[model samples]
Target: MDRYGDSTQKPRVHKAEVMDEISSWDYVIVGTGPAAAEAAVAIRELDNRGKLLMLGAERQLPYQRPPLSKGLWTGKDTVEELPLRSAAEWDGLSVQIHLGDAVIELDAGARTLTSASGRIYRYERLLLATGGRARQPELAIATLRDRVFTLRNFQDYERLQAAARPGLTVLVVGGGFLGAELAAALSRQEGLKVHHAFAGNAPLAHVLPPTLQKVVLARYGKAGVQLHPQHRLEGLDWEDGSVRAHFTTQAPIACDLLVYALGMESNLELAQQAGLTLDKGGVLVNTELRSSDSRIWAAGDLATYPDPVWQEPCRLEHWDNAEATGRAAGRAMAGRSEPFRHQSLFFSDLFELGFEAVGRCDSQRVLRVAAPPGGGKAVVYYGDGDWVEGVLLWNVWGKADAAREGIAAHRPLMDLHWVETLET
Candidate 1:
């Protein structure tokens, strides 16, 4: 048995894979998300004939979600274009693909899993890559009609793409990455009412500092996005194919569509139901990505592995982090005893302002900024006393390598040079 702990929870078995006699599979991954797919691929790369199987609840092939909020709103892309890999590729790799069937229960003691379709799968090693789910308010907007949408998967985006039209009012809730990206996508459409609401002071205040937050908010404000900060939606009025939303401290606002960008909830029901341990925030895994049970292993959004660099349990929601973590977990499961180590990194583009951040943002530290007057781009470094901990940049592309290197090297501010790289 193995165990790991996070935030405020006792170490529970994150994974425990006992040998199964019914059938033998070297590795059986339980998700088709980035983590699952990457793990499967890595397993194949490690052992040519390892006998692997991948299970996905969604019928669609593994696809990227980042573009759904961007291209779907713009009508420039479709679900068919977002698949992570083609069926031919999966076939080529001889990966057993089970779509639309969700694993409902795990028998860690017996090293088996039961699917919703009543199929029992036996495995020597198990990987739980079940990613997180986009959260929503307790109740639907009173003003919400069938047209209101939230893009959680390809199908959700398909409905949202069909609903976004000219003269439509798009009310975006939350100001984080999803909300901002969805709002930005709507800004490109003409004659659209794009109103953004947030409970915080500015957009992405959790991940960015006040100065950078202001820049993002200002950019959105200029895009004709009505800002309503410190506001909470009380209810929505739906009538005659339109919706009117009631606010806490303001008059009711009417809109044609509402998109909620609230955070995400890690999918841990299967594990929790099986008596696996869970941290307050997510599944807890140690350096080996092994749960207390030792029979199961978890990675990606579902698994909160320890970060060797930060010396804490950190979960990243970025594409690269997910891929790297998945690969590491897969390698570790395939008999590699290397420790899992990955630094968090994320970036986004909004018209004129490009935002990027490395490591976790520490609000307690001082932020040193490097930007000229009236320059649209800047890099903010987060330092804990004398050592640089993280770096964030705006209008700074191709410089992420330098920023990452600087942070990793613990370069002092005195030794760093900031040269203007913006094209004049």
Candidate 2:
């Protein structure tokens, strides 16, 4: 059942006397996002009588984030595509929500939280669906720094989308997935010149290995994107018509606009203050998504939980991982003791070039298998010798579920042996 709201019906309200008894809730979800929204639904499924209170950092209702990065810019997706739940739908859940504010302080021992506005909330059990912040360097030209955008939330997307125009030179600073995707999408514009300036040698340096990089680089080259590798931006100079991105060693690259896709930093101030364990994978959690403090459970990109699929601890920022872990944490909070055995399905849309990937798609793997090319569509299997760890399908269609299952089984390609060559 959709826990957000029912448009066809009216909401039933409890009497003033009954409302007085509901001072606190059985569960308090502090970040009203997809994770928190899903958590509320999952909690209702587990215990109908459980009181649920949600606190959002923003006033707007939680929305889908994937569109903000890739789809929204292309005009293929409308503003309606951004929302995960409508105001009416979220109201239908009967969960008390305080929008436009975040929990600023948390006392795990006392099981209480204080918001930015100084309102205190108490929870029996909690879910840290707190999101991440945009990772970027401080730019100069304070007045025109408005041109230096970072795509994270809806507002940022709107600004960048409106500003990026044909003939506009955009310097995207980051070598990660978001940076590359933005470059690819923006480069597709008729006259827009897109320059990808990153510290890494190649785009998607943090992820995609040589096996997948070759194909991706080829696509970028075909698209005519100016790749500026190993340019750690030292400063920025704002011109009357453009902003110049300066590097410590390389020549200054000036652009009409600059948008940094430098990546995201997990919002961990509250989590860290609460003394939750932290690592490279954000906030650490167990197999069941329970944090060091038993009363708190975390999900979404902020959580670095055990990935049973890959037998490693992973902190993923994709929608699939967030949806999976959010529901899992909600269910676990409701007494489900099973480990997270689900695979994280991540997808990136670069105009026509899109991919659905699972565990261990990044570099540091020596294995790959390139099948025979059929009509420009190629299937590449990557993983250890025994199993298919990561699968890349070039121009393939409708194979997401099959790809995930294939990776899970770790099935090695039979007709083709594992090799690091794209020669088909």
Candidate 3:
């Protein structure tokens, strides 16, 4: 039995039938990530009798992705416990799941989808929750594919885990959320050396302020992880079962395994083929999470919906956004129309430091740090002039709701009295 459950014990998954025998469904969902899974559950809550079908490219079921980088290494979570819902629960919901069968074509006019296996599925309403893929750097070391890996899905995690050994030196490329968390996690493993290299001066430089970036760098350094900041990866050279990474400004570092956490690229090929309106590399959707076509809806990382707080079209790749948007889109598809007004928050756990932040936490915005007089934990607000556009609680807990309220209020930073009341 694998982590996903017994391979011999199959659940209520639908196998590919004949192409001529068109299967009709009331709601057809593409992609089987958290977004698609939550959408199915939400739809069942409203209309239980509606025929729902979920198609996924991956072989495994929907599972929590954050644990792949955070909890898996800390011994806090196991791979068997990562699933969003069990097979029995999915069977009870009557949500027909079809794994390892990707939808290659979408006919919006005909309201049908063509799977890779050439089976046509007709639907009254469609939800595209096709999430993003890990962005890989264009390197000349394409021939050394086995030496490189990206942590996106469970399969990737399994491959990386199998390759990792006690004496192996692993080089983690990219300093975004994924890279930072992965470097921190891998460093905790005994007898393994971790090296983190990124283009920015510090980890999460694009999101965290300069002060916080320094703090994170210090934390990673304290954890015995080698840091290569402001280094642009130019090429790679394979040498006797090991790979040497060449950077523009730094010396080459040799490692047995390399993992790229460069971030994600939204999967937009299906939406583009369907002629959907796209913005900022994602499918454009309204406040109700509906696409240009009323019968089609988009959610999760691929859906660029109008953000009420940011007052602009934005797409989030966080787990919370996936669940919230998916639930809202499902309700709308089930004939319960309501605007997706829920404010989403994204949290990260990195080597004893954790934070839950709402709204835009961009580093470019004017930042105001409100800490105690002694300076332990703090609340950082980001905006221009008087309006509060984003908030970050550094090592602070139980203040995500207050942060959301402050951003939604769009008032001056001084008027947010709750910021001062936040304790360490």
Candidate 4:
């Protein structure tokens, strides 16, 4: 046996011996959400020689969550229509897909990961786009069968769609974006009674100021959406599978279904176990989206990184932020130095009205805004008496372009005469 090889003489090795080992990709993305999918493609495009593997928890191909709130629920788009890429497309790109199994643990020191199915993957660099999960409130009726539902994924959306039919009484628990959209969707269905409960005076009250909140509430009211402001849900009493929702404020309201849209918590268990630092609930990443563990990077809702445009720490759960952050994280993983700073672009539709915004809404600012000509308008929100903190619009498409550009350039909205001209 040749236990010892010559120090000076080179040892001959068969080509088969070197080629027998499977080559792990340079990058291993822990999720297949909007950010993960985008990151994978960007990585491939940036360096063609580098291998790419996208790990997803869901069985289905990567898809967008926005459509779950709008198109899918409304029956305007099918599940297939919202996928990140079709089977053929992913196959053509040579990007490996691992669906239906989540990464159970992360070993940063060893640069390896263990999946739920017991598969092990080693990577030179890892990206966490794990996203977040919906937070469900503790309500008694929520335990009952067919009485409560939380719209988080495709399965949840399908259940919600089936439950949101005519003559159904739905009590939406939260006045935030998801709650507002759900209420609007349920109200549009014939004979469906939708009552939305908010802990504040108006919908998104805490996030938006009194004036904008009032307008949002008013719009919801006009759309046959019942608003219960300043009230909290006590519990629910079930009778014959029906629910009587008890509130802290006035009276008990009988409803068939309850939906909670309070907020979301990032899936950072893997990051935490791997000794990665986190900000709030997400993995804390640097300007280049690198985590405390230099071998790892994070993006999407699971990442709490610095926002260059906002000039502060900001975490965005919007679709645009997901896409941008994913691209930035991918590039960063590839050793690029570009900053991952982003504009907080957001959009939503409640029945006939469409709303979009860029930057954080300056709830306290009073910017003179013009009415949308002949029907639609985009309202720019200001903060610090100068900066354009946010923009909100109704029935306005492409208006986000200006707000996005202005925020990216760090320009103050006050300099624009359009704002002063509308004041008088």
lDDT of 4 by residue, 298-369 (tens): 998998888777546677788888888999898888777697656757878776667777776655564535
lDDT of each candidate versus the true structure: 0.73, 0.74, 0.85, 0.74
Could you arrange the candidates by TM-score from highest to lowest?
Answer: 3, 4, 1, 2
At residue 416, give the lDDT of candidate 3: 40
**Sliding window of 10 residues with minimal summed lDDT for model 1:** 1-10
122: Cα error in model 1, Å: 0.9
Candidate 4 colliding pairs: none
Stretches of candidate 3 above 4 Å error? 1-20, 139-143, 373-376
Native-vs-model 1 lDDT?
0.73
- lDDT of candidate model 3 versus the reference: 0.85
Query: Cα miss at 118, model 4 (Å)?
Result: 1.2
Tens-place lDDT per residue, model 3, 1-424, is 1346333433324543444778999999999998898899999999999999999888788899999998998888998889888877888898888876789999888888998767789999999999999987665666568888899988888788878789989999988899988999999888899999999989888788877887888899899999999977887778777888889988888898888887899998889888999998899999999998889999999999989776589998899999999999999999998988888999898988888889888888946876676555777788888677888888899888877876787757777466664533
Candidate 1 residues lying further than 4 Å off, grouped into runs, are 1-24, 75-80, 140-147, 237-241, 362-366, 417-424
**Model 2 agreement with the true structure over 1-424: per-residue lDDT tens digits:** 2222222232222211223222566888888678887888887788777778888776556778777767666778777656786656766766667665668899888788887656677789999999787887676457567788888876677678778888788989888777887888788677899888888778876655565566667777788888888899888777667788889899999888888787799999878888999867488999898999998999998999877776677898988888888899999987876788888777777657666666676465636545464544555556667566776655565666676666666656652423222233
Clashing pairs in 2: 4-89, 5-89, 387-410, 388-410
Ranking by lDDT: 3, 2, 4, 1
- Please provide, for model 1 over 52-82, each residue's C-alpha lDDT reduced to its tens digit, 9 standing for 90 to 100: 8887777666788788767655666664577
